[model samples]
Target: MKKVTSDTEQQSLFWLIKTNSGRLSEADIQNFKIWLKASDDNHKAFRKASLLWRTLAYAPTLSEQPKLLEPEKKLRKKRQINSWYAVAASLVICMFITLMPELEQPTAPSEAEIVSTLELRTAKDEIRQFTLLDGSKVWLGAGSRLLVKLGSSSRHTQLLIGEAMFDINPNPQLPFYVQAGDADIKVLGTIFEVQKRNSGILVKVAKGKVRVAAQNQYRYLEMNESIHFEKNKVLPLPSKINPESFAQWRSKRFHFVNTQLKDVLHKLNRYYKSIIYIDDPSLGDIPITAAFQLNQLEQLLNSLSSIHNFSWHKDVYGNIHIKTNESEISF
Candidate 1:
């Protein structure tokens, strides 16, 4: 086997094999998480190694060995055998030369074909757009993480955190599914936005229709309809909303109608350089209606302070603190 020069890459490959083995205990997962968060280099190396492993695992193999040949052909045969051995050795070095014992090995070439996997992410203040292999489009919001998997029969995605807008291509034969928090959103073709909040998951439909399933119950939402699920329990009824106004964040502007102050602060924190702290927990539940560009956070907060009888001041650390005019508590 060829020596892997980079220690990070070698360790990443080992972890990848162990994770795919389907036998990791809870403690093992925690340790892996710690290792993954130790450095950006470790994360990148693991992603690279995972891609390589998946590609090789699904590659086609020779059906039969070549027969004995004449003297001249023996040299060619030797080179071919050496190449195969090299490939095998590399896989062994990665500790996944064959399928893990727990995994059922594929008996047919079709079953061995690889499913395409992609990981998409955005920086705290950045938004990104992606086009999947199936021609569906995704717009990931700031500080979001998404994992997409494309297979012959289905297109699936998981919104690990934050928000995304999906414009799915119509394909009845190949359905589209999104797993966000505890909710499962299924659709044939539609345009929708999904935001995973600290309190729940919110789904708003702009076009076509979608089925949101959670907690053994499901609701079908049509155009201009929206629903929120809390703790994996479906809401009683869907709400009517303006689709155009609901998606204004895609243009760097936001529209909020009767939104809680805490939720507003949570979204704005993704774009703000410093934290916005509400001194009183009860103040967070105050309903607020506002519309502004991403750059106008301070101005909007100032205007709200006068109307809501609240005062805000910046601490020495540059963090903004909001409190009611009657309270004198200090952080």
Candidate 2:
């Protein structure tokens, strides 16, 4: 295999290997994003390398050598030589020979000995889903960051910021734990959602059961149960909740029930590029109960202003400003 010399190819290959190593930090992802957006050539190189990687991942491995006739053997050798030439040509476009040793005889990792750690993030207005090495599934909300560590003994996940829904695989021997701020949620096998709000962390169970521990206390919650935890204290007992509304953002519709105006804006900010400002501090505490499509943010704001007697305007920079109306209210 020829060595990769092009700087772009080399850089793309470097990122490809690092990203697949199952240990990417948040900073590394940000840097990779910047590099990917730097030029079209970089994007092309990365894509080419990714395609090669996929092809290699699907390539078959031989368990034993086979006997063949002289003619068949010569033909197989010729095809193998041609295939190598083709691979070399592709390598010139996107270098991947650095992974030759591993690619030559790829083997699946043993489930009992697997250990991997990686960070997952979604940009503004973006929602993403991932499957962990343990076969558990996760749906990450917009502008969210999650850290996942999978080991033979335990599966750990940290919701550093934002919200995520987990559909965990049944592994009684390997307990699954999620850390959201000060709250720690433990489960054997369950479906649940966790969100980090300005006030505190909220945990909602959709299926099975979970134990939430915070502020030196722990509570067990069953399906359709939810609880909120503040920084220093846990709220009241777990309350019944609608399991259907769990992670509604994935459906492009958000349901807010007696949610504060500030919290609403905080969620909308994840999908909206511009900033939303409430000029009157008093308005931030207003409780709102509504369900709106993700794309109807502007309409939602308009209705809120009209019902709450507030006036709103968008600046030249696309930022929105909401203020109390000076005129008298008819209602």
Q: Highest TM-score among the candidates is held by which one?
A: 2
Q: Which residue pairs in candidate 2 collide?
A: none
Best by lDDT: 2
lDDT of candidate model 2 versus the reference: 0.76
Per-residue lDDT of model 2, residues 249-300, tens digit only: 8877888878899998998888778888887888999999999897787898
Relative to the unseen true structure, what is the Cα RMSD of model 1? 17.3
Which residues of candidate 1, in runs, are more than 4 Å off?
1-114, 232-234, 280-282, 315-318, 326-331
State every prediction's TM-score relative to the real structure.
0.60, 0.61
Q: Which ranges of candidate 2 are over 4 A from the true structure?
A: 1-114, 326-331
C-alpha RMSD of each candidate structure in angstroms: 17.3, 19.3
Steric collisions counted per model: 0, 0
Candidate 1 lDDT (Cα, 0 to 1):
0.75
